[model samples]
Target: MEMQKMSNGSHHEYETLDKGIQPEEESFLPEKTDTGKKIQFNDFEGKTSFGMSAFNLSNAIMGSGILGLSYAMSNTGIVLFLILLTAIALLSSYSVHLLLRSAGVVGIRAYEQLGLRAFGQPGKILAGVIITLHNIGAMSSYLFIVKYELPLVIQAFLGQTSSSGDWFMNGNYLIVIVSVTTILPLALMKHLGYLGYTSGFSLTCMVFFLSSVIYKRFNIPCPLEAFGNFSNNATIPEDTCTAKFFTINQETAYTIPILAFAFVCHPEVLPIYTELYNPTKRRMQGIANVSILGMFVMYLLTAIFGYLTFYANTEAELLHTYSKVDPLDTLILCVRVAVLVAVTLTVPVVLFPIRRALLQLLFPEKAFSWIRHVAIAVCLLFCVNLLVILVPNIRDIFGIIGATTAPCLIFILPGLFYIRIVPIEQEPMSSRPKIQAACFTSMGFLFMTMSLTFIGMDWMSGEKRSGGGH
Candidate 1:
């Protein structure tokens, strides 16, 4: 009896083993059949340690969503926002559990492959399209940050205003420069494991941003009125400083979708799991748990402090709200630079899943090719840069995509995949887990419907708002 490793890149048809795999590889090994033969498949040989994997996943979770969370908290109030945040974090963890379980049952690591396992070619196509669209939206949003914020950071550093008319201050030219120099190189890496260090650096930048937010809350005085002229200040109002426990308003409809959008890291989950060293369902799940929990705490603190500082004047984007107070403040300028660095590094991490999904859909049988990989990365960045540059208002496009895709990735697909992929004999329809999965799927549809309805109402009313800080 011996264990065999096949180098073919095909997604289907595992190489069945006549005997057991080595103990180190046992975590990902398939269960032995009645014939006592083990089943194994070709996967990217994982090299990332547990910590780096967690960092990569955490960076994926932390996006422009953090910026909008403060605004969401402003509408929902402190207590209610905490409830929604806690519930969504727990549900996101559960969804990852479902994905891990489904993958383990069939020894399929790629998300699109899991889709193919469940339904057919159509499932694979649907999964691929959703992943592509979702990540495209994500990449566009990150570049949008570069397009808008990088200019401001430069202006602050140079002590020049936007009216300078200098090419260095032009956002369009700056985004292109950053993409060619920074983002494109990182995106060209051969494996997701290689990005672990960049991901760690990105998260560190975010921690600095979060720390700055907390610091500003204490330093910035209350009743902070009259921004255009800093010399004029109003007296403090006791009522304005007080925190609200619960509240409801027309803007309340946007809160859930915003929170949901913040947690849409599902596309990256399986891929990170694929590259994790000594990977197991539990260890990957631990990675997810640690990453989610860390982001949850960071999100919670950022929202609470940001909203507390601005109170009624909080804008849809927390950083923008800070800008209205004092645009040239040194610490705030540094915070902007930190945020720019974080999101810039994150573009590559987000780009990996999109590139992988495209490969799965377009070239499932092909082995790793540098020509194809580099071409895809270059093409994707070019398209996203075009989208960011050409579109006058990306927030509206971002709104529509977030409303449709975020819930699907977060709630709908995982629930549907688990129910479809898991064997009926192993866990029947009437079983507790199956029933829970069904309910989870139904909840996704409900969330999608509610988000669209509210966003539609806002459109009809002609009220402009940020799409969860996209």
Candidate 2:
């Protein structure tokens, strides 16, 4: 009655039930009854449809990253930003396809398991650590949104003046309330497939946020308009609403990494593939393509509209820029609330891979336990909440995580795994797959090095500016 760990870290007594059959072999064989007729397990069969899976994957891809895209556009300008975003989305979709092909070839479902099959325990640990760091960074960014935006939203709703020091007006207290009331319950789900409902709703909230941005693009007064006196004969600046198409500056290097972060949903890709109805490499890839394309459109529109509205003045977080204009504006308040809800719901979705990674690392031999699941979910939320409160700059968090772990997960690991796992006979040195893998791996490393260098330069320049001011 020895137990075996499933690819997802859940354990089942396969040795006792199947008389020492390996799980990979069992995956391909059909069950038969006493009368020799094939038996079916509809409950165990994949139940998620293409649309639902795409929605869930799309939700995973789109997060608080959208909030910073305008700032990204400011860095790279509109034309270059769009080009980089398109390239990143295409490369990301290709990376998912590589992972899917690797999984399909080995008949494995979980990402860590695929790593184990490729490079054994070290590979598994690498996959787990990358997933952990990438996901924790994501969850913290979402809560960071909650920490900064929710209090302003509460103030707008209650008509409370900014000078008030009420406990209810505290962002820390509001984020805690949101984490407890909204995020924790959803994070406790034992299976990733069950999150489709909330994921769909979360995506809807993001759509609402996008729509609000488009609406405000035309409605909100420009920065100069807010400062100008209407009774006097003051003319608005001619360049106030002009869009910048191209720019090169120190900040431009961060734009690609930020866009890469927007599309780093690889940790959830295999889990979603496993739950997909009639799961196949092609079908799961279709889901990834659809999800990535949808998010790409949403991101382009959000960045364009938000950037057009603010032009050169777009802040790192778009919502904060809105608050400065008029926190009490009804539509602006609604937009803030939509973004807050979107990010809050996103926290739980990001938690899935982190919990799965920890399970693989710590308790691979143990079966799924309700106590462990709840405790881990609570601890993760608490730790991320603390980080969100302590971290003052969201852009720095985004840049560090997006530059380092994101590229590794999105571009490097999948390509390297495919090259190693897929037989040399199937993909030789001259083969297209091998060439593509090499290109992907090289691009990832180049981007990682350049991003880190630019971020360091930005930090140094900021320090110089501060020292000069003093």
Q: 1-470, model 1: which lDDT tens digit per residue?
A: 23345556474545436435432243455445456755335555677899999999999999987988888888899999999999999999999999988887666788899889898999998898888888999999888889889888887888876547889888888889999999999999998988999999999999999999999999999767643323445445555767787878877777888887788899999989888876779999999999999999999999999989988778888888888888788999998899999999999999999999999999998888999999999999999998888897877777778778888898898999999987686788999999999999999999989888877887898987544743
Query: Which segments of model 1 are wrong by more than 4 Å?
Result: 1-12, 15-27, 30-40, 227-238
TM-score against native, each model: 0.92, 0.86
As for candidate 2, its clashing pairs are none
| Candidate 2: residue 178 lDDT (0-100) | 87
lDDT of 2 by residue, 361-447 (tens): 888777668999999999998998888787676666656776788878888889888888777766687898889998998899988
Per candidate, the number of residue pairs that clash is 0, 0
